[model samples]
Target: MTINKYPIIIISLILLSLNLQAAENYKKFDLPLDLINYMEISLEGKTAVMTVFAGDSSQSFRMESLEDNRSYHEISYQGSVVLNNEGFMSSGAGYPFDLIDKTDVVFDNKKTRILFYQKDPESDVKFRSRKKNNISIFNDINIAGGDFIRGSVVSFWADIVINGEVNEDVIAVYGDISVGQQAVIRGDVISIDGKVDIAKGATVYGRVQASGGKKKFQFDRWTRWHNKEKDFSTIIRFYYDRVDGATPLLGVQFTDEDSLLPNVEIYSGYAFSSEEWRYYVGLEQSFWLKHPITLGGSFYRKLATQDDWLMQRNDNTVFALLATEDYRDYYEAEGGYIFGRFTPLSYFNVEIGTLVEKYTWLDAHTDLWSMFGGSKAFGSNFGSVPAAERASGIEALDGAEMASIILKSDLDNSDREARFGQSFWMGTAELEWLPDGWNDDFDFTRYFVRAGRFQSLNEYSGFYIKAGYGGSDGLLPLHRRYFLGGLETLLGYRHKEYSGQEFWLGNVEYRLTFPKTDITGLLLYNAGQISEEAGKLGDAEVKQSIGIGVSFEESLRLDLSRRLDRSDSSFQIYVRLGINF
Candidate 1:
């Protein structure tokens, strides 16, 4: 074998010269790994033509193999061609010589690089003999900011980034995809190991799925309609609260649909609320036994100051006794019970529950009570009831007496040294009508009526007519049983001035918006009162206040109001975030 070294060298030199001339006549380009079996590469002028065989077994040329096997032939115009792992087919600037069978090809101006890989022509696998497979696997297709027109079927298991918008019908399978806020995906997105981030203002029209061990999926700042159905089997939130001159609080919440069982939920929290410190611990569970049917129970306990009670007192009392002594007392309330709900239709749901609650004051005094309530929604025919009407309602004599008597009886039986006296029960119901075409043009009108058996006071019934156009910025909660000046309903009036169970409240507001920022300006009028008790309806004094305000940062609001009832009208300012309710 070593005897012909001189002759072999001479033949190689001649073959290399001829090969160099042939290379100069034909151009070359890169080919992807997936298309290696059926791709033919050649060159003509400045254009590179890549013929990909789609019949069956495709043939591909590996640049490294060509260099090694054709050592005798010289490559006059030499360049590297890349063959991707999946072999979808790609090329550099090589002109195509010919195409065989029914195969389609497209040239991308944005992607200027092509790849080439090694292949054996004498192998038993023929180019047109292999069966066609629907799923085309790509080693890696990296689209930085260009368009990738997937022909029939192409799948990838890598990263794909679209700096701009991607048109429709582009299916990409990957471990992860990080889409910028400016990026738009017009087709389906599927991921197995990675998560997706649809940034604020981004849009995705197809379904998105993130399976396997990945977590922490977030959807932020989206503007158009979005539907997200995710299985959050593992998620938790920890919350802590501390305030000056008050108690410190801490709690954790677990939100998993199956944490407990099918249709069953368990929630627990603890906190302390006192003049010096306040705290509470609570737990709740909810279960869905059937469609439109649910059952739930909860237990809670809190240790807080007597001052906290003042916050829950009636607005009329708070305003009247503005200079009351601070009740630095400690109390705890804990209880649990079962409840059931029924929804016969989409617009309406009714719930019934039995709950037993025990309250202990100063760790020595205790009382117990029970509760029951039902809610329903009528069709749109009712002029939508504003938040004010829903919040404020006449306290019916029977309902008020029932609540007061229950608490008083519990305290008497608890062997606690406390005020033992007769109380009242008042039950009131209101019907709000918002006609289909109701608007601010006509003075918004509401009629209220209440009737009940007052234990201490006489059995009574009262009716009132409230009319106003706009007072959405008023301090008072319009829907409350009675309108009283405070941080909510009447901005400029003192909290104690308004007292009693029955009173009329009204507010009218006119809003203006800026053309550039779209911020809103508000002018409002608010007024209302409370009576001495459930029955006696006389000496009804009315207080009117006007306020001017603006809303910015969407919900942050600021308003200034002046009482119009007096000559030296008093004014008050309020700064708040979010809606009143």
Candidate 2:
């Protein structure tokens, strides 16, 4: 070692010089804390351009040359610029391009402050303009594909279409924003007095606000938004049933094209089996008082049922046509009803209505045919149990002129972010009254209360529970009574196997959805009791059933169920559509 001290000293100096030279090839910059998730930076040779977004506010800075060692200055470009690292070389580059590369670079945004590092040269940066890069007023702004904006974009009295990338906030006042599938935004998206429409696969790193698009209270699942952009549309409906056979209806609807006008519908159809003409005319008007209130009225002459809670009409139609299974009893109801619905909160609704109708008993047709169960006859419209064995309250339903008042309320607060399903609690309470001396064949006061809850166990599974009780105070008409059995009720028994003036039912279900698929597996338990006499609900024998099912797209379903309390009972299979609750 003592022989070559001069050479060792010379080598050490050279290595030190190389290390210092490498250090000069990198650059570091501080970013706003709030914009850690809402900022983008691109380098073009010696110039560095950056945009930072904070809620509705955004700022942009441009550095001319890294060799100049100057601070970033504000720029006038409000739109995005395309970023490219092509044509970048380590051999013949000037400032920033000579300093940075694709590798050995890290973007650290998780900290309170963001740090951007650029170090080698396989990645040169380029900014290309497809259009003018600035805010707009009275004219729509469009960002074409492959374009990138380094600053916030603002538009007034117009719309914005983004098919590219935005480095900061995007704001639309009195306008709308439409983000394409491939668009990427590194900042907040804000639409005032309009809607933010995001296509699938679009990415946004900050909050999205649609101030003008509010969720409306849906009266029922059939409620649909009429195309406001169109004048009107025609609707056609068709279904099969034991009483009506094949029923087809045509209708036209007018929506809220003008704020002062109400939504109106008129439809008429013919029932081939019943040989009767059916029609429904309805009008609904909404007003925003202390809360949103809807006033509506309908005049209808058609087949009706009290068992709509068991299955939806669309799902029941499928079962009736394919399986020769009609879970609901039918009656001819010609009536007019006026109702008022109030939404005191986003998740709470109260409705009050009065109806006058002439009721006539319906007889099931023997010629009704099914696809699977060929030539099978439908069951009696009255039910499985004999009228004589039922309570005295089971009065005849034919030729009864009745007037009734109903009050109903429901509360639903559900979590929409669950992966498998929703987690929430929902409850409904209803009371119907037909006071004595109303000059009608029916005189009864009835009440029903039901509650249900869903619990999301994890991303794949959920638990559901529901319970209901219904009872009458006076002579409930035969058609007004409760029936508990197969399908949505106690799956262990036949349809309408049990009937009563008072009844109680409960169900528990666990469901698991397959990852990345619309398929779901279900395990469920159902139990219920029905009493012939009012106030004697628990006196009847309790029937219990356990079932397993699989569903596709949460619609089409196949189920296998068996009685839990009876060993003599065999398994029952069910094919249906839609959710029961």
| Residue-pair clashes, model 2 | 11
Q: Model 2 segments beyond 4 Å from truth?
A: 1-159, 162-231, 257-259, 387-395, 414-420
What are the RMSD figures for all models against the true structure? 29.3, 21.6
Query: Model 2, poorest ten-residue lDDT window?
Result: 120-129
Off by over 4 Å in 1: 1-245, 257-291, 303-332, 342-349, 360-483, 537-539
Number of the top lDDT candidate = 2
* 17-66 per-residue lDDT for model 1 (tens digits): 54445434532222322233345444222233334543464444434232
Model 2 scores a TM of 0.64
